[model samples]
Target: MKVKSVIVPSGMEHLTKFTRKIPSDVNVVPVTNDDSFSNIPLKILHPSKKGRGKNEDSMVLYGQFGLKSFIFMGDLDRRGERQVLQDYPSLKVNIVKLGHHGSRTSSDPNFIKQLEPELAIISAGRHNRYGHPNQETLNTLKMENIS
Candidate 1:
């Protein structure tokens, strides 16, 4: 695999430990703002403004594979979404990987309306303790008419 670099969330260097073997040439980048991988379609979009505590959902990436455009929201909450929307008012995406484990805290109504994704992908574990993919999120998707 020819990998140029591995970008990760800010303050999340510890997650790198799970990887098997990283080539010496690959530079692991931790993003603090909206940055894109040069010569690659993948990008990291930090929704939160500076000084937003921890920013666990720091590595928000807008990516494309084949002809599909999508964005991955890494546990981003409403506040983050608000900030992202405020910055990129006209942002649009074909698909959106729901953030905050589909918790109500993320995927705000106005934010979803702005993106108007053609499809919504919710990641969750079966019978998980957190009860992720909350009904409110599902209802929001339904209300938005996002498949």
Candidate 2:
């Protein structure tokens, strides 16, 4: 499968390892907030407010192939998600991967409502230390009628 990932420094090493394990023929696109790696093509987004001087924490992966668009928010919190929504008001996506393991820090109600995705996937380990898949986040999804 063709894959596009939002590159954040916190997870780059892990991402690189996983991407290397993928089949050679598959296309892997790494979109980042900064141009840290010279070898890989990068799409740099707007800089953060703190003047981090680079794309820090605001990024959402957009995967488009044929007629489908899938959006993945990697560890993105409410602020990051809001930035994305504000930047792209008319954004339409088929699938949404909940950020921060569906923690309350991510998946704001308004953000979820705006996406209106057909499928919402939450990737979190069961009984995680953070108590992920937070009840609040799940309730917000249910309120929006998203399964």
Candidate 3:
């Protein structure tokens, strides 16, 4: 299938080079916090204010699929996670894409407890240099009974 558009977080200058690399024929749509699509269940959820680092500026998305809900955390660290919880205290999900590749810096135990996700997804290379999928994070998921 032919790719059509690439949606990304807006107002981040660092992404300019990345966006420029996209094929000219494809549409580049930049979205910000709380932005929603018409007739779609997806919505962007990132901190609006500038963060201390690019990782903190990562986008978090919430979407609903039928009776299930999911939250996608894009490289957000503990600080960003705290802010998100403060902004949306009632937020809950059935699935979660753990932030920062399941690094210790991102998945705070409290954050996991609050979300109570049924499943957690950690994307990382098994032999990555940074040693991702930290044991602490795995312990958190296991303690929470998340698969």
Candidate 4:
């Protein structure tokens, strides 16, 4: 299979280091808030706020497939999570990709309360350094009754 294009958050083109390894014909599409995919139901929820460093500026995506809805929070911190909650007060999802790999810096208790995701996905390595998927975060998920 061949990759056709890469959708990167606007102003974060430098983050796509893998682009150099891809075929020259592949397209790099820069996207901003509220941008929707042509072939999918996903939309960018957070603006690509530059100068905030990488983690804070990570893209926040919301999408729906069939009757299920989900949100992918890209390394967002507590402040960013609060901002997202403020932006979309009614936002709820069946699945959520927890921010910052379930670190204490992200996954605010109130944020999870508001989101009320059925399942929380944390991308962290097993027994790796940095102590990812922190116990506090896990407790928050448990308190929220999320799987």
All candidates' lDDT scores? Answer: 0.78, 0.69, 0.85, 0.84
Candidate number that wins on lDDT, 1 or 3: 3
Q: Model 4, range 39-97, lDDT digits (tens) per residue?
A: 86688987545433367877899988888899999898999899999989898999999
In candidate 1, position 140 carries an lDDT of: 92
Model 4 C-alpha lDDT versus the unseen true structure: 0.84
Clash pairs, model 4 backbone = none
lDDT of 3 by residue, 1-147 (tens): 898877666655346567668888888766677677886667778856544337887889899888889999999999989988998899889999999999999999999999989999999998999999999999999999999
Query: Tens digits of per-residue lDDT for model 2 on 36-79?
Result: 45544333332233332122354556666577677878777787
Best-first order by TM-score: 4, 3, 1, 2
TM-score of every candidate relative to the true structure = 0.78, 0.66, 0.85, 0.87
- Model 1 pairs in collision: none
For candidate 3, what is the lDDT? 0.85
Instruction: Please provide, for model 1 over 13-108, each residue's C-alpha lDDT reduced to its tens digit, 9 standing for 90 to 100.
Output: 455453436666777665666555577677667733333324445557787788888988888888888877777788899999989889999999
- Highest TM-score against the true fold, candidate: 4
Candidate 3 stretches with Cα past 4 Å from truth are 50-53
Model 2 steric clash pairs: none
Model 3 vs. true fold: TM: 0.85
The 10-residue segment with the lowest total lDDT in model 3: 8-17
Q: Per-residue error at 19 for model 1, in Å?
A: 12
